[model samples]
Target chain A: MGTEDDVTPVARPGRPYDRSRDAQILAVTLDALAEREYEHVTIDAVAQRAGRAKTTLYRRWPTKVDLVLAAVEAAGRPPEADELPDEGTLRADLLAVVDSPWLGGPERRLAIFTGLTSAARSSDRLADAVRTTVTEPYVAVYRALLQRAVDRGQVAAELAPRVPLLAQVIPAMSGHRLGATGEPAGREFFVSVVDQVVLPALAHPPGPATPA
Target chain B: MGTEDDVTPVARPGRPYDRSRDAQILAVTLDALAEREYEHVTIDAVAQRAGRAKTTLYRRWPTKVDLVLAAVEAAGRPPEADELPDEGTLRADLLAVVDSPWLGGPERRLAIFTGLTSAARSSDRLADAVRTTVTEPYVAVYRALLQRAVDRGQVAAELAPRVPLLAQVIPAMSGHRLGATGEPAGREFFVSVVDQVVLPALAHPPGPATPA
Candidate 1:
């Protein structure tokens, strides 16, 4: 259900955008996010921490979700384009994601994502930003991996329509589970995720997208 | 990392336990949880909203996780077991979950789960509570579904270790995606989830719990 006159505020061009202030706000927001789960964080606290008045914060962020989203996007280090692996098989390429430092090491990213999702239950725009900024990197890697797989004919060309679901589910499940439980997404979880979930879906021939 | 040598303050038995007070606090916490994402909510705020002293809130809850867990447990409507579908095959029984109103309805439950998980990134007890209380109902249904499948010889024995992963991943993906994107976990999504991820894992021959 959509709400409010607008979920995101348009920049009024009232003042020049200050990159330094942007960075500071994000840094403070990230600290606050790390300190407490998203539900406990307040824009006022973030503003207080950043040494910016609430108006200064709102001028750019427009909404609390926008502010938090910007912070999380900044905190997350996107995989470098050069870092994309071209290991021969589709499996090896996808394994790069499994083995990637970006996805595996930090507890913070998962925590941040989970926190946004909890809020996203009510805010549609927050969810969009998450998908675009946070969910996009892995999705890009998955898309590349799948494109390579399809190019090699390792998977049927027909699997294309369903790639949206397939791409993010791994990161979504793995990250969410770890974020929620403090359990490391150990090698075992990754391997089973690949073998039991990802691979199986690919192997099964597709019918109509809708299930009976 | 363990924090203050003593975070959870023990009760002094100075007064009798007030069940009504306990209910009021939980109701307030649940409302707070429903109103905002977990990271943004604070104990002080919850206390203020509940019109209770912080000491009184802490006397019962001890930790933030403890308070939130109690609220979520209270808010989630326990599945009316009679509602479980007994369709002949395991798949049908499991499908009942996708069709169930509890998972599909208002965003509160998913919000509660996501918030708990975000905190759970740090708190082991909170994680246990989430899996135990929030995830347990579905896990139980999945266990029943799998037992029926194993009994019918529709699937092999070794799939047991992986059921935990299989059962929750759908809700995790679907709910997280919706929460983040404001998109519905459409029937098509549910159909694809079962077809692509779940059925294949079951059909694949059992191997060691961890992938080689």
Candidate 2:
């Protein structure tokens, strides 16, 4: 097993570099990850595939977890608020998100989660980095989309306030599908959750029902 | 590293045995897990603590993952449907599940999941065993409880049918809390998820909104 001493050294300020080296390294990491599980993917292998020196790889990432996280970060673009579709409804926007190739794909989500699980187990700093870099940004984009729907009266006003619920449920749904079936997420999964589960709970405000 | 040969032997039909030996062994397994993370909880240590022969332990379980999973199984009783509180309300029944001492405690749940993560990485057999023995049974209880509530007309009739949603979301919520906070799960976390997230999602029947 490689240890802390195996980390690559950082590049010096004066050295000339290939501009695409970072992308090359990241692409190699994804390919290796897809081919094997997280534990099997190593810095040496990534460097070998990228055709870059091990020292150069280490110069950029202090640990293998860091390298894997960087690769995960590079795998997909974060969901953007402006990119959200306006079908004149909150449900449509949610459908759009669930249906998007980014959230819906199995391999892509698994690749990201594999890095996350490794980081969560091995190092606290890496765990925090993953949360901020991968989890939070996507959650923020979803929340903003929901908030926009609320502002437009597409959804109830009170619905926008429950950030934690959306944050927790969406990922849980995806993770559950992955854990059980290892299949890509689908729009019906999200729509069922939002319509059959989320919407009804939100429809009635948080007070006692009126007397019959 | 104790390999496959390190396992203790199982009890045979003709063998003289201590009736309390199984309990003692399981207790030692829990103690070892609590003191050390799953990776460090060796069969040797468990054998030493239980004053049992290594071959005996190995005979019972061929792998460390099996041993650890057995310990988790012995730690808590399966949730029983008869034990569920039925106040004739969906919220109340869900809240009872949320507040279940076995499910709500962080250390126990975390330890169980830690073992699961390791098993998921190392052995497919262990993973399947865990899913069948632990996850499936617990889900069955919850599903039964929901079915009861639906029959009572407390929850929407259609809401009880989404097994995949319920099966995935509840554990995912608990796992997410443990991953994020590194703390025990609490009643508030469970209540918020059920009321704000799960109940609403379930209560809402899936449909397209009428053109406003």
Candidate 3:
């Protein structure tokens, strides 16, 4: 009677199954999230809204947090390392990343951020996924960029080895959206920070890095 | 009988009922926070622990959120505009603030941060105060420091002018603690960020400011 059975890939023969059905379910999850807070949104309600059987929803995601996280993931992939800009300079690369339209806007990012934080507090598995999938990957790309600068002798060899890459970028980018009334980061802001602040601290004159 | 009153300033006698006793009450509120989570902590519990009357606590704060906020305020002020380090350079100054010992260690900051975010979800006043008093002060100091740089012709012209600076330093400083793994900010790490990442980004020559 419904598209549920058709969309949901059935499990092998007698085994449990469904792939396309899961996608529809995840889409419905997003719709439900928009309509209600994460705490109030439930699996039964999601199934009801999707017009799918309750068992189908449970089979895909074990819990509401898992479902919510899956929906977030479905919204977009993390900015891939290769997708990062490298215009032969660090400043330009940072600006590109900061201003990328594909990246979720401040409001959406804030929602994901708060959701991640809450899920982390409530469940360890979600925390692990966030660290491995989101935090670490982005940090690695920046660290790689810094490493390239260090290799080119554009920055002090010691600088890239020690800096907390994620710490520097995330704060400036997320500050305002996270309820800070500060000026939002943009191309000039990114460039200024890179040129005025980052480069000076890192450009060792072919000597030992000084004590901070 | 209680030292809470002694440690905290007393209310004035006549002109108006001094709100100073609220400070005393909040001190005890912090003591309670150290022992319990936000859900478990209560205003009556705070009054009982402080040896102050419940009516006195209610008269000043009126709600649990207000009481907790007063405790946060009484804990100490955020870094002041003048207090931002001025070691003849912006990089050193920023490193000082990020690595300041008086700001409380990472764990304590995380606790306060988590508590505040959790409270803010439900209470508008708490949310506003967290943004205004705690978050804005730090952002303002950063903006002021950047403004000083701009004045020195060390940074770009037309930088976004605002009371709360949006350049990302605040988030970069706090992100690690608030995020999943919750790492602490250290002096050397901060210096590297200020030097390699932050200084270059903010400097005028658009290159490294100091030799690494």
Candidate 4:
């Protein structure tokens, strides 16, 4: 439904690319994703919401996948610092990740998650974006947490390789539930994951170190 | 792409609804979903692939979500017997579910999964289909397995309510990995889930009957 009438000039040309407008487009795009399902959302809708031209959005992101990926990559900014406060045991540390505002809790995060999975299934750009922007940073935090647990003798050294995949579990589970209900998973759901899944996986007894 | 030239007209009315044509449509739809990502896939495309008119396919399923849901429900028919061989422990039972041919292995299953998750985010019909066709049955089998584990005192009786969510863990993990790599998670990935995630979550020291 893009018409010339719908195309608002994004400021006269040569007037500094207006980085704020790009940010505005990304923000509206994310809001659109959160408010509607991926397939139902359109770039025209985003442009309308952002008060920009469809041509302006098309110039930056040629397709919906490109736009969605840019938004997801934009949303997944690494926390300013890596060293978390000593949250006592590994359970608390892991729980802190879940409890954190950023780690897959918000409605917008779910939107990015749903879009990422759908796009990454076919697009290499999104797949790489998922790996670099979403996967690696999350895994790094998990690895560091598990190492701390190992040093404290809470988790076994043998479970090292397996710990990284654990990083994906809670987010995946939350993402799964969110797809159905369009709401972030509750605290109880996360508590079950930590109490039942993560801690259980790592509770290797101290005797006869069985290699994981 | 759907054209009268390509259309294989369904048998005229009063004759049985071409049951085989229905099957062909479902099969081609599944193929279409696997061959392309969810958004790019269309009813016309599926109809074209099945060599049937779009009207014929539309008669059976009104919208793309309906068509996709039908294809998913068709793909996920769990053969009626549920009495699993008691593999002596919860670990073995869980492994059997993961190892089952119908569970987490097929390309069509992944396609259905991707399509369902993508569509379900907004459509209640797709969401319910996913819960019933995709999530519940799998959860039922897992609940049965865990029940057996509890019967043998291998699992904590207190963890019953949480068991169903645990059932989602393996499929969710595999789904996440599949979305990125577009490949079914290998045997090793399922194994890690059972060992590291499920087992640990249920690992209660066989001491007192402490209620969870």
Candidate 5:
């Protein structure tokens, strides 16, 4: 995932790369990924689809893995803490989080994720990129929202310590739904998970914590 | 997934397929699947690996899809309703469900599942096979266990209608964990999900049912 500074010609000795075209190239990369598996995605195809020279993509991202990682990173930038919705209630915030277009909605996001499935298993870098760029941020946002609810006395203070574990429920379920069914989990499904599962789980009085 | 009757020679007009050997071939199919992506698995390779003639395999399962489907079905036999654990409590039943060596335990199951990721998207039959063979049975077991708890006066009766929705939480979360991290969700993770998410959600008092 390169920023403008990484592509600026000052870092390289040769030709000046057109920084403005990076977004288009990345978008095409994602499209290529969405349409095919990771092993099948080639930098050559990406360049041709983006209507750019091979050298241009190579100068920035040296390998297919690099390009895919960058495209995924760009397509799913992690939300800043302040950028998350503060809807005054955990349920509202959780609902808003899923509704936001973080990775071009659930359909496109699932396509992109499925595209990287095989590669991620073998490539630690790709796994880390997906975890850090896509999964971790969502989990963090949920955790923060849960903590916020506890602080507001909407959720029980006794459950505050369990916030970290509870935070992963919605994201895990959403990801699982997408992976297992090969269908995007829509707003309705998200609402059900929030209302039926997450909200209810939060409502439970803390039982004696079992140490694993 | 096939029963013993499927391989018996009574139905076929040609050479008698070794009904006993069908299990060995299916096991090899699963091994192949666990080792490689669906596209990469070949009947020739499976025959070689299993020390059987290619024609023999073709006689039994005509195509790669057919063989893979049969293998998956064989590997993951859906539990009969009565076969599920009735451990007196819903939590114990769920823990038992996860702990049961269903699909050869979590690690092999995850490997087998990840191997099918790409093909499942395009092949409706494969998708259905996975859903019916793997996902549906687990969901059903959880649902039954939850319903039993309601019947036994352990879980709240108000939550009875929510059984179907609540049942999916553990399976969906487990599936998500496997897909995202490419790791087997072991007993410890399963216990956490049950205690921290499933049980808590079950404990929550129902609100006015929101219509989708």
Candidate 6:
């Protein structure tokens, strides 16, 4: 998997640490986290895999939780508000998120999520980290997308308030699939969820305007 | 928490086993499971807690996985189709499921789910057990409820085909909450999901009939 990107050193402020070096180590950490339970993932192993000294990892992250959280945060970079896909229709906009890089591919991302979720079950800090890094960013992106649709008159203005909850539908289902089945939900499943659940819910909100 | 029901031994066929005794043991197992991870739950501890001999417990359930699977199955008895809530509205009927005994109360059910889900993340056997014991039954109940609505002309007939997929929304979200935060998704949260997501999705499914 080594490419020219692995050799390219991106600049960062505050310290002399190379951003690409941090990215490289974090990527390795994520791969290890994806493969095994959190307790089983040792910093020594990550350092070895990343071709860095264990002391260097300790100097950077100090704790396994810190390292893991950093890796998760790095990998889960949701598209910025300006970067959201605008495919004209609300459905298309949402569908675009299914394959978005922020989600990663089906295999690695779900495995990483499964590992982190299992860890989160015992540690409140890890749970909070996941909510902040993984869930919230995705939720924000969805809310932004939904807001865009609302502004364009693609979705009802009355449904605007529900953007927060509605945004969670896909992420919740994806989380559930990994937790319950220990497998990644594929594109077809996401499509089914968006089409059969999310869109329908948006279209048929039980508001004052609805008939009894 | 001990009651007269704990002392009552309901009769069961085969090997002269008492149904109530089995129920009592399973309840204890569920409680322990709720309190900690699956790997930490020992048969000897369960036997001691249940007031049964270790030999007796071994004779019945042979392994930890077997015992756990049995306990989960015993707890998750979805109501019969005829027993579904007929509140005369699809929304009310769906909401009634939130408070159903089969789901248990918020605390115990969610905790048990978190434990099972964490275990499921590592074991395909446990994952399958959860699907069979917990998820499938709930899905069936939801499908039945939705079908009942269709029969009553409450939900559109065209939405019948998506019943199975639609039935999964609440369970998936609930599963996500436990897995991500190790917390029960509260009644308020369930209400929001139903009002904002499930019902709306049912009303607005994507089909050929939908306007471009």
TM-scores, each model vs. reference? 0.56, 0.71, 0.64, 0.67, 0.72, 0.69
Number of the top DockQ candidate: 6
Local error of candidate 3 at B123, Å? Answer: 4.9
Per model, kept true contacts as a fraction are: 0.35, 0.65, 0.33, 0.59, 0.73, 0.79
State each candidate's chain A TM-score. 0.62, 0.68, 0.62, 0.71, 0.79, 0.77
Ranking of models by TM-score: 5, 2, 6, 4, 3, 1
Model 5, which residues run further than 4 Å from truth? Answer: A1-11, A28-67, A81-85, A99-128, A148-154, A204-212, B1-6, B9-11, B28-67, B81-84, B101-128, B148-153, B204-212
How many Å off is the CA of B166 in candidate 3? 6.9
- For model 6, how does the per-residue alpha-carbon lDDT over B26-91 read when each residue is reduced to its tens digit? 888888888887778899999999999999889889998888877766665555433888776677
Per-residue CA lDDT of candidate 1, range B70-161, in tens?
Answer: 77555553363435677655555555665565633445544444555455444556666666665566656666666667666677776666
Where does model 6 exceed 4 Å of error?
A1-20, A29-67, A102-128, A204-212, B1-22, B29-70, B81-83, B102-128, B179-182, B204-212
Q: Per-residue lDDT for B102-201 in model 5, tens only?
A: 5575566556766665446446688778777777777888888888888877877987877887788877777667656666566677777777777778
State the TM-score of the second chain for every model.
Answer: 0.60, 0.68, 0.64, 0.70, 0.81, 0.76
Candidate 3 lDDT at A170 equals 46
Q: TM-score winner among the candidates?
A: 5
Model 3 chain A, poorest ten-residue lDDT window?
A203-212
Give DockQ: model 6: 0.42
TM-score of chain A of 1: 0.62
lDDT string for model 4 (A1-212, tens) is 11122224466666645554455577677777666656777999999888888998898789988987877666654451266636766666666665566633544454555655555544567668877777667657777777777776677677665677777787678766754455657666777776666666677432123222
> Which candidate number would show the highest lDDT if scored against the true structure?
6
Candidate 2 or 3, higher lDDT? 2
Candidate 1 accuracy as TM-score: 0.56
Error of 2 at B167 (Å): 4.2
Query: Which of the two, 4 or 6, has more TM-score?
Result: 6
> CA lDDT of each candidate?
0.61, 0.60, 0.57, 0.65, 0.71, 0.72
**Model 4 chain A worst lDDT window (10 residues):** A1-10
Q: Whose lDDT is higher: candidate 3's or candidate 4's?
A: 4
- Candidate 5 Cα deviation (angstroms), residue A51: 6.7
